[model samples]
Target: MRFYRQFRAYLVRRKVWEVTAYLFFGILTTLVNVLIFSVAFRLLELPWPTSNSLSWLVSVIFAFFTNKLWVFHSGASGTRSTLWTLLKFMLVRILSYGLDMLTMWLIIDAMHGNELIAKLITQVLVVAVNYIFSKLFVFADSNSG
Candidate 1:
């Protein structure tokens, strides 16, 4: 009960509505990723994994900038710190992306479902995983990069 009060105060003090807004931006970014990958893979005859990675790389840049400026409103860090943040973001995402691929591979290749359908399911899960890590880990502040 006491801990709950402290948590509520933290949220209120920090204007946690801003977090919600950031998450909304994340949702849009996720849509952008899916759209890019789906179009490139399905319509443009690009390979599935290739399209997925390329889309993620592009969207990560978008997500990073928005998160730095709007979500956390983090002050400018030196180049090393900025690079570290991006590195951490990529490292955190690697496992989640791998899991997404495994799931899609299992669903589409093993189970013989549609690849596009499997991608849709994986996209939803990956977006949530990324959002949590991006907020709590990648963008976390520290004296050391």
Candidate 2:
């Protein structure tokens, strides 16, 4: 009971609910990506690489909206603010995706680590980077105007 209370208090104090929401929506976004990939590649007979790229594009757009509205509750109004936020979000995601790929390469190829373990570790790092980027840079300048 004491631990639970302490954990709850910490969550509230640190606004961890935003992280929780982000994760939930992130999972949904991933599922959407996978589904699109499967449909495009397996069902529609599209090339695998093309399907993968399309899925990634769709998922990133979905993630941006969900993270902005549901997770961060960004108050930056106006069309310019929205477009600027989106550009920043895309830039940060691109950087983090590169970091994730590099982490995987270092862990798996250079270190001879197991593929699944390397991917899991890379994902953790990616999530931390993404959260920090989203919070501190991407959605940080909302003026509610």
Candidate number with greatest lDDT = 1
Report lDDT per candidate: 0.75, 0.74
TM-score attained by model 1: 0.76
Stretches off by above 4 angstroms in model 2 are 1-14, 96-128, 142-145
Q: Write the per-residue lDDT of candidate 2 for residues 74-112, one digit (tens) a residue.
A: 886799988988999999988876776677568757897
Query: Candidate 2: what lDDT?
Result: 0.74
Worst 10 residues of 2 by lDDT: 115-124
Question: How does candidate 1 score on lDDT?
Answer: 0.75
